[model samples]
Target: MTVSFRDSIALHANALSLREKRNEILASNIANAATPNFQARDFDFEAELARASGPAASQGSGVDATLGYRVPVNRSLDGNTVELSVEQMEFSENTLRYQTSLAFINRRISGLMTAIKGE
Candidate 1:
């Protein structure tokens, strides 16, 4: 039986990619916090994961149609939607999740190597 690592590790791999993209988006939001009329953008992680593990798997890219603008809780007079507190929180959370996914993939790879070694 042919064992495809892609199939076995798709979830964690895609999740890591998605989390990286999210981190970029959140960082961009923070960078643009002072730019007038700049709308904060983000993507739905669950939806992107679904798409990444679905028909879009062949595309080999993490991005999809899930990106959207964040609604401001308190609209700024400058029309910027990026909230520093919220962006920082999301960035930190995403970083943690990314590290978790990376660790999981590493463990999985190690287990596979052990199995192949028959030790």
Candidate 2:
């Protein structure tokens, strides 16, 4: 039998990439929370992931609708769409998911190593 690291780690690897991107986006939203007219942006993680895993998936998600600005629960006076609390919550969740993806990839690699060792 052949060991395909790429296949085994593909999902987790893609998740890590997306999670990192999400983390950055969330951080940016938080950073610009006080900036007037700054709209908070985020991608549909599940949709993006499905598209990414497709056979002919392109790196550029294009100008598609997957990316969107978050709607605030309460509108601000300065026209800023970034809700600080929401952004913080999203960042924290993304961080946790990123850690989870890392753990899954690590376990997959360990299992592959064990299989390769034939022990």
All models, RMSD in angstroms: 1.7, 2.9
Model 1 lDDT tens row, 1-119: 88698877888988988998899899999999999999999988988788888874774665554789999899799999998999999999999999999999999999999999998
How high is the lDDT of residue 77 in model 1? 97
Q: For each candidate, what TM-score against the reference? A: 0.91, 0.89
TM-score of 2: 0.89
Query: TM-score winner among the candidates?
Result: 1
Question: Which RMSD does model 1 reach against the true structure?
Answer: 1.7
